[model samples]
Target: MKSVLITGASSGIGLQLASDYLENGYRVLACGLDVVKLKAVLSHPNVTHYAFDTTSVEQIDQALGQLSAPDLIILNAGNCEYVNDAQQLDAALFERVMSTNVMGTVNCLSVLLPRMQAGSHVAIVSSSVTWLPLTRAEAYGASKAALDYLARTLAIDLQDASIDVSLIRPGFVDTPLTRLNDFPMPAKISVTDASSRIRRGLERRQRVIDFPFLFILVLRIFSWLPVSWWQSIAASMRRHSL
Candidate 1:
């Protein structure tokens, strides 16, 4: 069987994808911070579970050091925390989000890239929030924005080596991550739908997999607007959400 490894496999979309991939007959290497949770969620004969904080490269290296490379690697682990007050500019909050969502991915990539070879695929979970600015998403949006560029650049650089990179950008996936939102989430999709679409896209080796067409279409349309115009729209949303 082809092998697939997924980070953030303890809960949310990660757990869902791990389950679905295992069902589809892939040997799964599940990674997360919680050992017990990973063990309980992916308790299959073909699934191997590892626990390590994503932010620490040492821990990641230690965890992945001895493993044979999986044919597919999904770097889906991330954290989401909003900036409640932009005027205050919470450095700590920004760092917390960046460390997990940005540096954490980088930490994993540092060790994992060598294991990827020809015919290997790597998918990174970025957010649709990167399509346009959102109210109170300074930290979250910026982190995903970084991933957007990282994935695209990797695609270009890795092409000659025959390694494929896919950027997974979802609009309001209804996972545990989105449950923390206080404002209304338009066009939220269930984890199952999210997993199905993502799998189909990866199988095709699509460079970008954006879900819930209508929602992303709206964002794409607004993305073409003048900066000032979009800023006005964002300000309006901030007022309503606040």
Candidate 2:
């Protein structure tokens, strides 16, 4: 049976994807920082729980050392922290977000890429925030933008190697993390729908898997607008959100 390894499998899209993959007859390696949470969420004959801090390269190497590479690897582990005041930059917050979202994926890839057989697929969970600047997303958006670039670059470099890299840029999904949002979220989808979209995208081996047609479309359109126009709109949005 083909096996898939997913980080951040304890909650949100990662958790949903793990369950969906298990039902589809794939051996699931559910990796999360919290072993107890992983066990509590998933219990299956073909599912194995791996606990490791994705921010730590040593921990990732040690944890994944014993297991052969899986057919698919989804680097979905990430954290979100908004910059409440852009005027007052928070270096610590930026570090925390970057360490988890960007470096965390890099750390995993550093270990897994070598062991992965050719034809294995890797998906990195970036955010739709990269499409257009949003209010209070300073740190979060920057990290995901880095991921977007990283994933695109990897796709080019790994194409000849027979490995595929998918950049998943998801809009708002109804998960615990997004529930904390105080602002409006247009076209937000359920976790089940999000998982289904991601699975279908991966099956087709799409290089960039962005989601929820209307929402992403709007962002794409807005991104094409004049910079000053978008800045004014974004500033207006910030005013209303407060």
Candidate 3:
């Protein structure tokens, strides 16, 4: 069976993806911060549970070192914390978000890439928030924006190595994380739907996979407008939430 390794398999999209992949007959390497929680959520003979703090390089090395690379690797682990008061400039908040979303992924790649065989596929889960800035998403949006660039650049650099890179830009997935949002979420999709879309895209080896068509289309349209115009729209959205 083809093996698939996924980070953040404890919950949300990661959990759903793991379950889906297992059902499809792929050997699963499920990585999470807590082994107990991961096993509680996912228990199967074909599934191997790996516990490691993605933000800690040493932990990742200790857990993943010496293991042969899987056929597919999805760097889906991330943290989402909003900067409610952008004016206050929360350096610590930015650090926490970036540490997990950006640097954490980087830390994984540092170890996993060398072990990956040719023809393997790697997918990066980036948010559609990168397409257009939203209110109070300073840290989360910025981190995903960085992933967008990183994934695209990796696609170009890893081409000769025969390693396919997929950049997944999901609009609003209705996972446990989104349930905590105080603002309205337009076109939010369930975790199952999100997993199906992602699996279809990966099977096709598509360079860019964006979902919930209408939502992404709206963002693309607004992105075409002048900065001032979008800024007005964003301000209106903030007002509506208030």
Ranking by lDDT: 2, 3, 1
Winning model by lDDT: 2
lDDT of 2 by residue, 52-86 (tens): 99999999988998689999999999989888888
Winner on lDDT (1 vs 3): 3
Number of backbone-clashing residue pairs for each candidate, in the order shown? 0, 0, 0
* Per-residue alpha-carbon lDDT of candidate 3 for residues 1-242, written as tens digits (9 for 90 to 100): 99999999999999999999999999999999999999999998999999999899999999999899999999999989977766798899899999999999999999999988899999999999999889988899989999999999999999889999999999889888888898889899999999999999999999999998999999999999999999999999988987
Candidate 1 per-residue C-alpha lDDT over 80-161 given as tens digits, one digit per residue, 9 for 90 to 100: 9988888899999999999999998989888889878899999999989999999999999999999999999999999998
- lDDT, residue 62, candidate 1: 96
Considering summed lDDT, which 10 consecutive residues are worst modelled in model 3? 78-87
TM per prediction: 0.98, 0.99, 0.99
CA shift of 36, model 1, Å: 0.5
lDDT of 2 at 64: 95
Clashes of 3: 0
| Candidate 3 global lDDT | 0.94
